[model samples]
Target: MSPELYITAGAALAAVVVVILLFKAVWRVAEPNEALIISGLGARRRGGDVDSLGFKIITGKGAAVMPGFQAARRLRLDTRAANLQVSCVTQQGIPVHIRGVVIYKVGDDFASIANAARRFLDQQDFMTSAIHELFTGHLRSIIGNLTIEDLILNRERLTSETRASAADEMSKLGLVVDSLQIQEIDDETGYIVNLGKPHAARVAATARIAQAQRDQEATEAEQVAAANMAAARRDARIKEAAYQAEIDRAQATSRQAGPLSEATARQEVVVQETRAAELEAQLAEQRLQSQVRKPADAKAYETRTLSQAERDARIAQAEGEAQATRTRGLADADAARALGLAQAEASQAKGLAQAQAISARAQALKDNQEAVIAQQLAERWPEIVEAGAKAFGGVDHMVVLNGAQGVEEMLAKALTLGGAGLGLARVLLNGNTPNDSNSENGLKATESRE
Candidate 1:
């Protein structure tokens, strides 16, 4: 490159740099936190209808400003805080000192910027002092309208009252209050402090009561757990004792196992020996039954048979003798009966003859009963003798107690019986005794003769 061309290029580059710098100086930008106020030049005339200040406002953008004909001023739209302290009285006439902070910013609208630019553009750093003075008067007025209780507890009401009291005046300044906070209050009479004493005491008492109740419940739970632990320990000890007893019993039983086994073996041997002895005894009994018992039973049976046969034969002989005695007695009885019947007939015939003779004699000599009875006796003499002989008809032999004279006296007695029948015949013939009596007298006389 040529030297002249190099100088021309350098000159052109310097001119471009100067133009860029001039453009930068003339083109002012408004940040989001600030507004640019342009006055002088025809730029003010562009927004004079809206703001009536002949100033143009730009915010959050850039505008071309002529260097000398127009001027740009930055009005900060960022938030600012002002501290306020005021001595005031509440609606209840309680004197208090209030300390607060008010947060505010310049309005971002063009008219607000124009209004702010006309008033505070040259003294931006003095904004807090002006806001602090303005809000102090407003806060005093706000506190005067509200009670101490409302100021203490009602933040919304405090804010609303602040806005109501300061809104129009701050609008004239093109400022908006973002917040007005009452940071602290000093009660000269201790009224506000006294107001919270009862609630604080009640909250303290309630907290203490809750803590005591929790402590009591925890103590009771701990005591119950201790009791349960003791009971569990006692039960565990009892169970352990029972298990130990069982273990001891098992060990004792194990220790006695040898003796028990030996006793059982001995018992088994004894039982076997007893069974063998019993078998031998049974075999001996069977042998005795087959040998000695059979022969003894046969001998006893033969002797018993012979004794029974002999006894039976003797019984038969005695029975035969008794039968013969009975037959002989029967034969003698029959013969005696026949002879007695003959004697009775003979006596009856003799009595009848005597009765007929006495009856004939009584008829012949009606007053001579003795004579007639005597004649009946004489006529029945032979029948009397025959009836006396018939009395000995069944006797095979006779023994006279005396000599032949006894025979003569027996004949006389027999003849006297015939005379007794004479008395019966006399009674029959006379018709003084009954016939039955006469027959009875006749039977008596015949029995006497026998």
Candidate 2:
């Protein structure tokens, strides 16, 4: 066993059988969403397909396929979906029931993946019921030209009427309808909630007529503010009854004036006691005519002058005794002178009958000179009213100083005291008595024996 150690163990057993036949003639592997379509006999050309179906599409890469001339297949590009249930007829021929969905893929341009791998490769589970019986006869000729409001609000005219009715039978099965969706539409009558109900009842009757005209203008402004508060309470009760009657007429004129000035001061004290009793009855009638008629007219003028001097001495002693007794001496002196002339004619007839009764009482006082001056003014009318009462006898409190010229100067000093008692009765009728001789005096004693 030596020829150099059997040539080094026969070259290590021929390099371990050429590494086990080069790992069984070239190894390979690829996966992850697949693409391993190795064709028969030496497949290789990728990308832009070249010739015969002798191919190679090892996606994520792996190779070593020689087993009996090499061949393999697995082509699934991924995205796909199709659910379409349709029963249709429209164009006013009604009869419709449809529900749809169709999203497709497996055509990233490998010539639309070799035309969907020659029509679904091998009936890929009936490819969604053969695309829902070829889209239910193309959705009944696209709802026969459209009506149901152009299939509910015209979605771009229902996708241009579904691409003008399935674009020539999906281009004879090349297929590219990426989406054709219409989830539901099943109407037999009740049109669409009676189209909208009349415009919502005209917007609810215009909001109830604007709320009844704002409640009648708030009740006529609250009754005109209660009639202006009852006319201001009747003008404040007529100005408080005219200020209480002007305070009761100024308290009744101040109570009459105080009893009219005390009745004019008691009528001036009874007119000063009736003028002092008329001056005491004119001083007692002038003291009874000055002590009883001037002493009885001086004793009747001394007893008539001693009775006419004793009758003239008895006629001179009887004529001297009749001539002394006549002795024949001339017939006795003629009878004594006829008896002394008959006694001197009887004493001159008694002194002419007493001087004719005093000249017939002075011719009846000068023929009744106003009845002797009204009987001497009625016996000296109380001494001419007491010299007119001495001019109010110095009036004690008389204030009649000048009102009416002091009562007309006290009535002209009481008529000048009756003209001084008629000038003292004309000086006692012009003389008389005083100391008579034989005039038999007194009542004027024969005017002093003139």
Candidate 3:
């Protein structure tokens, strides 16, 4: 194991390292997302009947390219985006703004790779700009054929149709569209906003009607409940009155029975006393009996006479009262009938006077509408000025460029809008016919409608 054996081992290791470096320098790898385009010298590829394409495209593998005779270039096969912002006019002559993105990549087939390599091998950085221009023109064309509604609601149609439109062109450029999306559309006019207003108003009207119906139903229910409570109160009062009448009648009966019972009890006592006297003294019995009998008969006769007189008096008084009530009823009926006729006549005369006055006033107004307006405006001038001044209530700042003159002009302009009410009043007073004569007063009428 001396110096000669060591020299032999060192030479073998040097040869192996040189061969590995040479292999690394000659071999080129194409990544999964890229294709290597090899041109010059034996780089031609042969397919079935067609001859070689004059170049070789290697994808996802390694190939040997001679250092001087062959040139290898990479064409990326990864996806790319081309943004399109186009202001285009639709088929309906409507201007629209569209923003979208087109996702594209180089085709995977050999033929597509050949086409791409031939054009983009040296200019891969500008590929997106070229696609952007291509797709921008295509989008304009596509948008020109479809309407705004189609663009908004039928985006899938737009996509498919756009892809179909640019299919041949993209194939020539060796591009395949993975997705074409229309992201935004801006309409300059407010057609879409006004479109839903009618439906919204109808829905609002229906809601209001439903709310009113519910309120009316609630009000009716409340009224019915109030009626029921009042009826209960009335019935309770009637029942109490009936019970009170029964109590009063019972009390009157008790009061009437007291005097009769007292009279009967005194008569019984007198009879007992007479009987006792008869038993005690037989001699005086006859005398006492006569005296008691005579006095009792006299008292009885007086009571009978008084009762007959009182009955006669009550009968006469009742008869007189009935006669007076009947006379008064007859007189009242006659008086009421006369009063009714008088009132009817008075009402008729009053109605005729009112009708005449209304006719006269109407004639005057039709003849002198200007006078009527002048009178109304004169009466309500202060209120009109106050209402016009309310327009600036929310203003926190005021800038007058022309001092008092500017203030006057601003005030006049603001009052003009509020003067719509005055215009409406004049329109009402006149029969839609305006008379423009110079006012006797210095004030001039700047606005008038005829």
Candidate 4:
């Protein structure tokens, strides 16, 4: 029973394995990056007549291929890259060798798939060589139309030119170019290098100039910031010093407060004591005035009154004696005058004889006025000396520095002043002499009395 069962199971398992192998061969699956190109028989046509290739294209799914009746081939649609090297001349007629890479993929559309399948299905490994050869001619054309400057710097112009030069050719190959990159440009005559030299030098110089300016501005800003920092530090130090000074002053004032207060209190006590002393002295003075001065003043007044009355009595007694003497003298003069009148008649005859002699002497004196003035000066010499001595009357003390000589000089100066008066008298006497000689004699006597 086990042998029969084992043989049956073995046969069934082999059949299933063969069927699976057969199904895998007929049922062709297209991967994400590939397309199934089925042709030969019962294959549906796709795209229009212009692009139809009597084949059916399937992508991203499976299709039943009838083995001999219909044949299916896998066409790769993945990206492929090709290296390109070309010798070309730029629009500026500069010869250059360019090296580049072109990235491309088979088209996803049915028409493009059919075209690629027809061309590359048998030679999938030769795709890169085909693309490289094709792109090489297109790159030459592109470089011929563009300047080295555009190729080197203007990437957009380079890309656009590449697209314009290769688009139709790539479409015929059923390939889409994702990118064309120019990797290197070798200038045989150094045309491209020389062309950029001036611009490069100018740009380098401008960059250096800008860098220098920026450096200078940065230095100035740094210096200004340092100055500001120094100023801030100095201000802070000044404020700190001022605050310290204020603190010291406050401390000193606080330390002295107690002593100053005590001194003020002592001064107030002294002032109060002084006021009390002054009030006591004033009270003493008032007591002295009331107890002593009033009584002393009254006693002195009484003494002065008694002395005045005694002096008045003595003056009245002396006045009465003077009146009695004057009355007796008048009586004696009346008697003498009566006796002189009897003798006056006898003297009248003698006076007439004396007048004749005096007239002769007056004529001689008038004839010599100098001799008259000299005689008069001799007669008034004693009176002149007395008048000169009166100059010293009010002096309390006489101190002559030159001793007796000084006293003599002073007396001489006083006598000189008296002589000046004598000259004046002489001038008066001279005017009076012609009119009245007796009047001149009387003026001389008055001068002596003065």
Please rank every candidate by TM-score, starting with the best. 1, 4, 3, 2
Model 1: per-residue Cα lDDT over 1-450, one tens digit each: 899999999999999999999999889988889888788878754434564577777878999999889988888888998888889999999999988888998886766666677789999878789888887888788778889889888967877877888889888888888988888988989998899999889998998999999999999999999999999999999999999999999999999999999999999999998797667557656665565446546655665676679889978966885675455446666676775576566556756766676556545656777775665554444556567667758889655566444545554565456566766776676674355456557756765775
lDDT of each: 0.77, 0.59, 0.76, 0.77
Residue 415 in candidate 3, Cα distance off native in Å: 99
Better of 1 and 4 by TM-score: 1
394-425: candidate 3 lDDT, tens digit per residue:
88976555544455556567645645666677
Give the clashing pairs for model 2. 28-63, 29-62, 441-445
Question: Of the candidates shown, which would achieve the greatest TM-score relative to the real structure?
Answer: 1
- Prediction 3 TM-score vs. true: 0.45
Q: Write the per-residue lDDT of candidate 4 for residues 300-325, one digit (tens) a residue.
A: 55656666788889788667756754
TM-score of 4: 0.58
In model 1, which residue pairs have backbone atoms overlapping below 3 Å?
none
Give TM-scores for every candidate, taking all chains together and pairing residue i with residue i: 0.60, 0.21, 0.45, 0.58
lDDT of 4 at 69: 98
lDDT of 3: 0.76
Candidate 4 local Cα displacement, residue 396, angstroms: 34
- Give the TM-score comparing model 1 with the true structure, all chains together: 0.60
RMSD of 4: 20.0
